[model samples]
Target chain A: MENTITSIFDMNIKPEYLFIHLDAVDNMDAIKQMAVNLAKQGVVKNSFIPAVLERERIFSTGLQFDETGIAIPHTDTQHINSSAISIAILKKPVTFQAMGMPDSKVNVEIIFMLAIKTAHGHIKFLQTLMNQLQNKVILHNLINSTSKKLLINNFKSLFNKEN
Target chain B: MKKILVACGAGVCTSTAVLNKLKSILDDRGFKGKYELSQCKVAEVPAKSSGYDLCIATTTVSEVKCPFIMGIPFLTGRGLDDVIKKILKELEK
Candidate 1:
């Protein structure tokens, strides 16, 4: 329902981001709690958990890449301030529902949380990110990134057209 | 002619996204055929008496019986290759 225009080509998202190094989270319940806590603290705003749960009520965000419990929870842009993204790294790993794989669970340790600001422009952001996700090289870099700075720089570089 | 049914919670938001993806994939494959797109609730798939060539449902269905292509990654790529293949197969039919 949001009408804001945050574009991937506009370079709206930056490395100045907020994140929770889930060096200890072990379950989806905890993941939900961290997101809820951020929402409560005004770090993410009111729509984070609602949007996440709602989209998930439809489907899951778990991508189960590398079979190491990593996934992304990207909701609609209605609950966004801008094109800000948050990353959550779980220490113990958690099981999340997969797209069509019902009985099988996708493990999630790393979450590239997307907070898009527009109803339409988010499609482009998703395409860009998903392209990288489909690439083994970029996925490996993301999985190996240890610091926030590293994650930011690498992602920015990937999105940086000249890179 | 084969049909691909797109279903979602309300048949509005994400179904639209999936529709966009299907259009692009079909166009890219150089196939010439019109696809039948039906948006419905997750609970409404079976009751509809249409033998769609392929069903692209964005969410989980209880006991629905059809070849369903999940759209979780119509928004991403990891789940997109198979989706493209399914749509292409339907187009070839």
Candidate 2:
């Protein structure tokens, strides 16, 4: 289990992958900008933008936390070249359809755009992420952290703690 | 063993997370040997849900044959006790 977690939690989140206070008026715009940034970083294919958008339209990754609203937008492995997670802190919260309840809306401030290369390969990492999000203090720190370096360090520490 | 189906959007990411959490919960409740778990995508639920005793999914689905439980609480840590109670009750029946 430890080995599996060590391998699965190998997130390629760098300082460059972290965006702070991005100016996106809507959910699509937020995903597009993040996907484009990930593509430029050579983490995902160029087709990732559209595919992520379509998946968001259908599945709707919007999650409502007790303290704030966050979204985890991801698509199939076909649209990705590698596995990477990009973090974007929007300047203004954008409206997103809540997960499991499409009729409900969540105004999201932070977006975790996941670019995965395969299905069923990163279970440990994904579980750790979900468990981490449940902590209000961690989410609060993530959203309030202003420095990109600090954010990267904070995320790395969180992932590291799981393994 | 009782078969339980768990599903999410891509059938890979969120569903697996739910699966692990459910496994531990069931194990803690002394249900480790009594239950079996399966994971799939939401699109496959309508087709595959018939074989399972219960379907626990993170995403909303159309019509499923068996009793369905929402698995979001497993992730968000909100109302998780109630969700687990529902699962246990369904398994008991």
Candidate 3:
């Protein structure tokens, strides 16, 4: 069995989980695709997909930034096996109900699907990611990165500076 | 000290982000040591809200005993000043 102690500290974002120029029909399609991929990677349980979909419906994750929009979709900790952040740069923007305002809509070009295994364990990473998201230059670079490798490099660099 | 509750869908991601941002904002605005922030799932708001002086959530919540503020501004950096003013106003009351 994988050492539980080591696994708990190994929640770094995996490159395989990063998707660039990903093609999806809509918000649900994007989330389902990412959730399914995370499940295959053993980062989340098979039940994560349905739970995330249901959660997204009730509490939308669409955040509209100054220059672009992004969505962070996630579910309960019970559906996750380990902690990971799966990022998708959509080939085309998809409509998602705005966070805290279901009546409004946002065309999200980036998706950050969070598979958190514990309640408060990943707060530092989450805070850093939020601060990065608030930076227009970083958000632009993330959306325009031509390749998955480039995107992951840029993404990792953002966190590297913080730590 | 004022008790502020920050909540999101799962209480893990967005709420954590909002809580940290809120804390820094409060600290910068000289609200240090004046309040305590707690994170929880949106589903747990109604039950946990009464103990708080304010409830800020990334999603819609109902039946909250304290004043409710939408925390999406903290994530998007839009209207954050207004939200902070609102939070300070609530904390003052």
Error of 3 at A40 (Å): 0.9
The C-alpha lDDT values of all candidates are: 0.60, 0.86, 0.87
Interface RMSD of each: 4.4, 1.0, 1.0
| lDDT, candidate 2, B11-31, per-residue tens | 867888899999999999999
Strongest candidate by TM-score? 2
Q: Which residue pairs does candidate 3 place in steric collision?
A: none
- Candidate order (lDDT): 3, 2, 1
Q: What is the lDDT of residue B57 in candidate 2?
A: 91
The positional error of residue B77 in candidate 3, measured at the CA in angstroms, is 0.7
| lDDT at position B83, candidate 2 | 99
> Per-residue lDDT tens digits of candidate 1, residues A1-163?
2223223554353333434356544445555665675565444667678667666645665665543545556565556555566666555567777654566677765676665555445444555665566666776677677776676666766776633
Model 1's TM-score against the true structure: 0.69
lDDT score of model 1?
Answer: 0.60
| Candidate 1: clashing pairs of residues | A69-A107, A69-A108, A69-A109, A70-A108, B3-B53
Better of 2 and 3 by lDDT: 3
Rank candidates, DockQ, best first: 3, 2, 1
For model 1, the superposed segments whose C-alpha errors exceed 4 Å read: A1-16, A37-44, A50-58, A66-69, A75-78, A81-83, A161-163, B1-21, B32-54, B62-67, B72-83
By DockQ thresholds, what CAPRI class is model 1? acceptable
Per-model DockQ: 0.32, 0.75, 0.82
lDDT by residue for model 2 over A1-163, one digit each (tens)? Answer: 0112112365567767778998997999999999889989898888888888999999998888897899999998898887888899888899999889878898898999888787877778888888888898988888887878766766766677766
